[model samples]
Target: MKEIVAVLGPGSWGTALSMVLDENQHEVRLWGVDSKQIAEINTEHTNKNYLPETQLSDGIVGYTDLEKAITGATYILFVVPTKAIRSVAKQVAALLDGKTKPVLIHASKGLEQETHKRISVIIEEEISSDLHDGLVVLSGPSHAEEVAKKDITTITAASGTDEIAKKVQKLFINHYFRVYTNSDVIGVELGAALKNIIAVGAGALHGLGYGDNAKAALMTRGLAEISRLGVAFGADPLTFIGLSGVGDLIVTGTSIHSRNWRAGNLLGKKVPLAEVLESMGMVVEGVQTTKAAYELAQQKGIEMPITEAIYRVLYEDADIDEVIRDLMMRDRKAE
Candidate 1:
């Protein structure tokens, strides 16, 4: 069934997802704050600054007005950064009609910096239940750059309710983009957010001229750390092995397309955090996620050495080399 999908953000990921909706024959209303980018999307059918070298589908209309983009939409997809999710959700809630309840789906992956709340939680808190159908989290190993080019990408659309998850799956499932459904929203959201922290560590390993063996160790240990913290939060342990878990960890940790990985690579070279962020010209979510995860792990009494090492380096101004050394020198324990 054709539906009006309002994609909020208009960043690379949002635009790429919009392309998928366009291919599915849906009316895509892409909303963003930047007038120039919105105008470019409307007129030139391109968003070079974000998704460079990729031409967007002409059918994907861009809108600067929040109300105009989502007034009649059946689904509202939030792709904004973690920091902006609450603010954006509030804005959407204010403009949405009381009688209209669109299915709320978020592709953004990260816990809120201040509250350490998942994207879905923040959205639900901001948007009244009467104003939306249900909340679903769409996440996996898919990158915006690859998805923009129609590369074969598989992901998970997860919701507490199976029906809601399946609804999202049907809309995005097609050639080159496969969508799977999962009932574990907690696991899905955690895996999606926690992997970014490890990706930064993996990139740092590469930046430090470490061999594949070192990266493998870091990622392996990183997964265990992620799973430990996740389970503490009441997430299904099995979900950590699925697409949003180890799969997402691999892609984000290894791919150059990951902003977190790129940021980590720069950090590994001993570059200052502020300068690295300024140079990237994009949100390095892991930088903020690391702090939240670190604090959360501590609060939960979860043993997450890798997360702690990255946290120390990111937040405490610790030497990367010394942190790595301390991590390696920790007492032996069962694998």
Candidate 2:
């Protein structure tokens, strides 16, 4: 089945997914905002800025022009960062043909900074109501680098429409990369964003020389907070117990590959947050997402102590020991 697929973003995850789709025998066009990166991948078939060492698929064509990429796209996979999701969504909307319907698969995580909306929400606002039902959010524990290596990874393809979900599943699922269908859009999106905050918490603990016990405790309690906020946002609680929730938590919290966790690790090691991020050359979503989550919690009256602690540490320059003390001294409650 040769389907035309356009992936919007030239970052590691976008490139890796494009490679996967290419291997699956789909014609893929990789699009990005960065002209140099698009030119590099288009000419050399490699993302030197992101995934430097991995080999890209020959069938994958890279394009910086959004119009060129989305011209004949049947299924569009959005792989851009969360902060840029809306801007890219608007670009996509402008270039979208009113006649040719495309199933939108949102592969990015994190809530919108401006409207506090999810990527799927932004897409729904841009595309026609007819296409709104086709918006899908794809997420899991898979990391971009490992997926680029052809490692076995399982992910979820969630949408309001089962027909669209099936289409996405057929297009993306492979022997090494398995894509399952999920109906819980809020759960999947929330799980993806919330995991980064917990990953930062876990990474901070690791940087502070805490063992697995502390990390596990953070993960469990973090999921509780995640569930609380998610339920407030209309997500099914059980969805948090699935791959996008617990699975993503385990992977991001434990893996050194996670940029959010890595950033927190540096912060724990006594480096300034700005300095750490500047050195990484990549976006550590947790930093921005923490501020967003903190605001949401305050507005919704949600209790997220761990997130607050990280927020204070980042914003107020709170003493780490005192921050830990505040978390530990909280009134005990049932689990």
lDDT of 2 by residue, 140-227 (tens): 9989899998899999999988888988999989989999999999999999998899898888898999898888899999999999
Model 2 poorest ten-residue lDDT run: 125-134
The TM-score of candidate 2 is: 0.97
Q: Model 1: residues >4 Å from true position, as ranges?
A: none
Q: What is the lDDT of residue 117 in candidate 1?
A: 98
Please estimate how well model 2 matches the true structure, expressed as its whole-model Cα lDDT: 0.87
Tell me how far the alpha carbon of residue 307 in candidate 2 is from the true structure, in angstroms, after superposition: 0.9
Q: Please give me the total number of clashing residue pairs in predicted model 1.
A: 0
Q: Give the TM-scores of the predictions, in the order they appear.
A: 0.99, 0.97
